[model samples]
Target: MIRRRAFLATCGALGAALLSRRAIAATAEVLASLRSARQRIRTLQARFEQERTLGLLATRVVSRGELTVVLPGQLRWELLPPDSITWWITPAGLAYASSRSRASADRSAAGPMAGVLDDVLVVLGGDPTRLEPRYALEAALQPDETVRVVATPKDSRISAVMRSIEILIDRDLISPRRIRMEESSSDRIEIRFSDVRINQPVDPARMRPPTEPRP
Candidate 1:
């Protein structure tokens, strides 16, 4: 009985030590890791699968896509199947086109929405600097060496669109593996990325939205 009691005490002490380490980890450490990753990443190309769950739907909707991002603000997200469209983002605004019609729409009225979307994309694209000041950032370094960051928006307009955002980043790879966006309407959009390629030369043409006139 004495031996068992001693073993239990040792286990309890070890658990406490581990928990303490996790609890005391500094936010600066997380920030530094993010900064390091951001520096190493200039561009990102990946295949992603997105699942959107709605409050009333019995079945969740799933979509497959390819994403490309270049530093200094450019992104192309191409959706496939059912209905196909490609969304392009630039510093100016958002543009999208239907693959079937090949007609593009330049939605300048969507500038506010574009800003919010860009903010989330930039963070997931590995540059969190822009968001750190605008959002309350809480980060935890998990046992697997991945960092989980939860960001709550400080801006009322952004908060109105999204309640919060969560991201899982691979520290060693300096890449984001998943992002979950929680909308104020109780809808959830989760995107998982795979086959990621970073800093490789991307065609300049791919960076531009479709040239066809807006419909």
Candidate 2:
């Protein structure tokens, strides 16, 4: 169960990675700018490719997925191809649906994921200031005008699961282009987003796990 908590926490960190890629000095002004930029966002939809490289694995494992986030607290991430799985974090609780099964099930209230579910949900909600209190932030400008932001966790709970997160943002577009998360165990996960749509109306149903009987 400890392993599961770590796994989900790492996965949830992906969403907030984009929040850090501001090309500016690490100062109050920079933090304010970041907050203002992300605050403009209300709804977001994007497709992402997550590549996980583990210390024990000789090759990277890649997964493609699409995610939808609706402000304060609703999110849905669906992994496609090789296997289909959907994870939903909503007002009610956390739930998941697997293609291999017919029912959408809710996570146990005291489950391992319970501890970090809010962390994941908040990241997906695109709140830039949400992580401010927990990480020491730094940003540098690139030759291409892209900003690289690095965030080191200040909280042991977060640092225990991962080392740090690095993000590259396209300054002109004011959007994140790449994110790399480093883990303590020498595992690395990189997520790249494409076809990003912001402030768009996403189907509410998409944020809810499917309700159907197991067949």
Candidate 3:
């Protein structure tokens, strides 16, 4: 009877150890995945073809851009070909869009994107530490075996411009596949990445403008 009791006790101890190992493994996976994701984001540049679909028709607003991102909160959205515009996010609010004439009218506007700011900052900046207060975050399954994150803004006006923002990260690499911005009126801005480079040399002049046109 004592032997049986001791055997059962051993079994219980074994089960507990197995469970503890699984929990530790899960933690390690989470940490490894997050680290891989941050590293992938460190060197990312893509050429994007933006299409703005207004209610009835799909209009091709073609813009080929190179994005250079530096760490937790620096990004440059440069539009080349068909037109020229740059959306800069220096964590403050730095952006310049071609005005009416491309040469004579670059006006200042209001909102998060107007200056050195971007919605991605909400997540890439401090969301890791304080996710709840800044965004309503959720995850969904994707066909490509990726887990996608949908972020709804806590900021008022920006939320109006965007219903929700989605970031699709690879199952393995954990790097972003696409950044999709859904507008309130069912319009969407989808930026998919290809030919991505990480942690490469970036010229400061790439973020600099040739001329500032004041309207």
Candidate 4:
């Protein structure tokens, strides 16, 4: 617990330093730092909104959204636009909501699934190592600095719902800058953060479960 919290906070605090400065730190050192980084990341609640082009549909769709999260666990994502959807992950399990869509009870597992919260946190907490086996990390160290990690699904569900997930880590702060969620033939979902608050006080209500439907 101590180790993880420290990791999370450092990642949030040293967002800039981790970018271009390649430390003489060993791989273990680097990995250790990332692990702690993920733990201390206390909270991240922000607005993620953007306009996207769908090549398959041959049209542009605009969407606005926000997500709020608390340390080591707990999060919520709401997308409002071409389609309205909200997904919440709590200690209890996964909850998906749309106009009338809810995750089947059988599919709502307690822990974060590979493509769910674990993936979300890896990006937010700045650890490419955890997902490295699946994604190839490409980084830059020059006039323009950026670290881009791309993941190609090795399984059917991952491949069916997603072609690949691309993460953009801003070189200056070592924090996530953007996340590209792509699908084959071009329908995509991209999340760009703004008003991002890390390790700050957040509304507790945001972390609570959503209202359930009537039986």
lDDT of each: 0.79, 0.69, 0.58, 0.63
Model 4 agreement with the true structure over 1-215: per-residue lDDT tens digits: 99999999889778757643444233335445445656567777778875576887798777888877775667787887657888776655677777875662323443225354556666666455676565544433334555555566666655676677776655544466788877665787777877776777877766665554432
RMSD of 2: 12.6
Model 1, range 1-215, lDDT digits (tens) per residue?
99999999999999999977775466557876687768877788999999988876656889999989988688888888775888887765677778556544345677457767888777776567568777877788889989888888998887888888998887663677998999856688999989888898988788787763333
Each prediction's RMSD to truth: 6.5, 12.6, 9.2, 12.8
Give the backbone clash total of model 1.
Answer: 0
**Candidate 4: regions farther than 4 A off:** 1-39, 80-85, 97-117, 172-174, 211-215
Better model by lDDT: candidate 1 vs candidate 4: 1
Which candidate, 2 or 4, would have the higher TM-score against the true structure?
A: 2
Q: Is candidate 1 or candidate 4 better by TM-score?
A: 1
Model 3 local distance difference test score: 0.58
Quote each prediction's TM-score: 0.80, 0.72, 0.64, 0.65
Candidate with top TM-score is 1
Give the range of the ten consecutive residues with the poorest summed lDDT in model 3. Answer: 100-109
Model 3: residue 177 alpha-carbon error in angstroms = 1.8
lDDT of 4 at 196: 71
